[model samples]
Target chain A: MIEVKNLVKTYGDKRAVAGISFKANDGEILGFLGPNGAGKSTTMNILTGYLSSTSGEAYINGHDILEDPIAAKREIGYLPEFPPLYLDMTVKEYLYFVYELRGCRLPRNTHLKEICELVKIDNVYNRRINNLSKGYKQRVGLAQALVGNPNVLILDEPTVGLDPKQIIEIRTLIKKLGKNHTVILSSHILSEVQAVCDRIVVINQGKIVADDTADNLSRELTADHKLIARIDGPKDEVIKLVQTIPGVVSIVADMQRERGVWEYNIEAVEGTDIRRELNRRLMSRNWYILGLRSSELSLEDIFLKLTMGESVNEFLADKADDLEERYKEEE
Target chain B: MNAILKREIRAYFDSLIGYIYITAFFAGSGILFSVSSLQYGSTDMSGMYSGLFYILLVLIPILTMRTLSEEKRQKTDQLLLTAPISLTSLVLGKFVAAMLIYSIGVCMTIVYATVVSFFGAVSWLTVFGNVVGLLLLGAAYIAVGMLISSLTENQVIAAIGGFAAMLVLYLISAIATIIPVDWIARIFTELSFAERYSPFTYGVFDFSNVLFFISATVIFLFLTIRVLERRRWS
Candidate 1:
């Protein structure tokens, strides 16, 4: 498990990472979602011991990151935004050097060989990193990070430039790796996090805005569930009937309005399914129903609603506004 | 450290800097040797060694120019920094590699010493002392070059900076003649690399001058380490 207690990073007068605390459990795939300069990379760099924090502390497993850096570093594998590889060394040589530098002590050459096979870059092991395509080089980079088989893997934008097929393959690999190691992957693609990560930490500016399970965040942000209904009747009459339903809130006349059939959107209370009730009542009224659908909050909408879409300081201000409003309402 | 040293040497060979340096230095000395000693009917082996000392100002910069700068350009320093080794070991390894190559060129001057053995009587002690002084002098030059190389990421800047620095040291003797040999100038002239080496070429082993050469080498290398470490902070 990883614990961060009031982690803060300040650059001169600006605080890139404000006093924030969170925990990432073992065998968990945590996603860090944020825009550029949101302190996601800074946080990761500090955790990996690449950069020292201005204040606060991070504990990887039981070891303090600052006090016991080498031990903490030994348990973590980091792939920074830029894949740090010797351009002159071939894939095989670079990985071996990393193995030695990491002081794995064992025959890490065999370990690297196996990881290259695992990441499917065995064929390009002889190629110089500068010569390979971006995707293959990324795999080579991943192979280097994974060579020591650290318990924690921190990947910064791991699949930014991959094709659809390669993205799928890497996502699957991350998922498989997540079974054994604690993984923290950072990206702007909410759907990618929704797909692979068990938990998500949405950050804005330098502060974490939302942290929860994918389903929980989506559910918490949804104010109401939306649905579409199609009825076989005069268009105006169907619209009026949908409006009369106690649970139904609004309707919009959609395509196929020319004929005696009408299709309209239905907004109902969240977690209340009105589709079966509408179908039963419409059948009793001798109204032939055409189509019915309900819309749930998408990850994108939840992301937009939960995040204030500004600096972390700004987001914090908006959060303070939310608290003040709640306080006034209570008063 | 060995890994870094090996790669640095290989990088030098892979690029033209290494080729141009080894070629020009050895070739320049070969030409100067053939023309001065072989052509002029002079068999004083020490004359040839002294000739190589003058050649050093131009060639040592080439040998050490890209030592640290190329690592910064190609983003390869990240690899060395993130490695498990300490900063001192890494910098020393690269410095030592460049120093070893310099020793190779100085070792080549031994051929002139051997050639003189057939024609005229050569004092083995003086010849050995001159060779030792040349090695120490070349080491000091290379260390100065390495320090300059660490200050910039541009190979051209590093090379020019190193050349300029060595240029100052090479002209130290001439500078002594122009300036007052009073207390200050005399003290500065005592620091001149060539002035200190005059005893070695004359078959006199001056331990104090040798100590000065070693100290210059150690100071420059220590400065290089500090500059490299400061970069991580920046």
Candidate 2:
């Protein structure tokens, strides 16, 4: 378990982490989702007692990192953005050193071997870490963090540089570790978070924007749906008719997907579906309704909207009435 | 602390640093031994022990430059600092490791005394006193170098700064004479480690001088720990 309270870190005139707070329950994998300069790594560093925050406290289990650092640190295993490896040492040597560094009481033979097998680094045990590939190097980094079987694991961008296969392997390994240890994994990759994280906390510009379970976050962010329609009618009339329909917020004409047919994106007010009424109105006007389908928001869109400093409703409104404004806001 | 100490000692032996440092120590002291004992046919080891100050002056920086600087450069300090270990142990572990290598280097030079013993009656008490003096002086120098290493991440800068600082301390007695103010000159002379170390080389087991070298070592090592602890906030 972990708790952070009003953590603030400042560098001269700039705040790297601005009074942000969050918690991860026991055995929960909390994914810290953010883009570059999001203070994700800064938060993780403070939690692990690697860097002191300017004005707040972080606790591991029940021990405060500042008040009782040794006890708090004993409960954590941290893998920084960089692996923090000594390249000259062999993989086995490096892990053993970490074991002793953590002051593990377990027998090194069985425990170290078990960790090596858990992270799938047994084959490269004897090889020097400098000679290892990026994938193996990352695995060794993970293996070191799992030493002493600490209850909490704080990993920052654990799968940043690996190839696709290695990414999946590391994700699977993290998921397995989550069965026992409380994990706080930080990454800008949404898919990685969606795949492995039980709870997601979205941070942007040194602040927390959204925190919820993956399913709940997706549902709440996308309550307002957009519909794509293709109709054989005048663009002006189509826009005017959709505007008059109740619960239809805004409609923007898209490029014609077919010859002599117009495509329009229509956003409906939250908790409303204007599909049935619109279909009837187009039929009454003798305009051919070619097709219509709802396009629900994805996690990527949710992340972009939150990090762009626009609420989901405001983003949807902007997307319907003004495409140019949305693009500008993204920049 | 033991874990860090073991790794640091293994690191020195694993790289070319330990071998080169030991080789240089033997070569430099061998020349001094020949000049003092063989050339003059003297059974006393005071001259040879005096020559040790110069050998340590050149090699102490090389031995301790990487003690903390390399860890900072490679970012491995994250691993050590984040562990359950205290900062004091981390600093002391590295300090002790460098002292171990310097001690072994000094121990190997006892063979020079053995060779001199075959030619004339050598004073074992004098050799023992000088050996203790050499260990204490080397410990103090290593502590200073470790402090310099902790202040910077660049090994070259640590080495150069350590050598410069040691150079000044080594010549402190001579430099004191050029000072115009008598009281200030007296302070420098008293602070000069070479002046305090002169008694041990002459087979005089002055306990105060021994305490002085040990206190200097403890102070520098304590300062290194303070620097590391302050880094967590700044």
Instruction: Please identify model 2 stretches exceeding 4 Å from their true place.
Output: A222-304, A307-331
Q: List TM-scores for all candidates, in order.
A: 0.78, 0.86
**Model 2 docking tier (incorrect/acceptable/medium/high):** medium
Model 1 clash tally?
Answer: 2
> Candidate 1 chain A: worst 10 consecutive residues by lDDT?
A308-317
Q: Model 1 off-target regions past 4 Å?
A: A1-3, A12-14, A59-69, A221-304, A307-331, B169-187, B197-199
Best by TM-score: 2
- Check candidate 2 and list the clashing pairs: none
Model 1 Cα lDDT, one tens digit per residue, A113-159: 78988889999988887799888877877887796788899898999
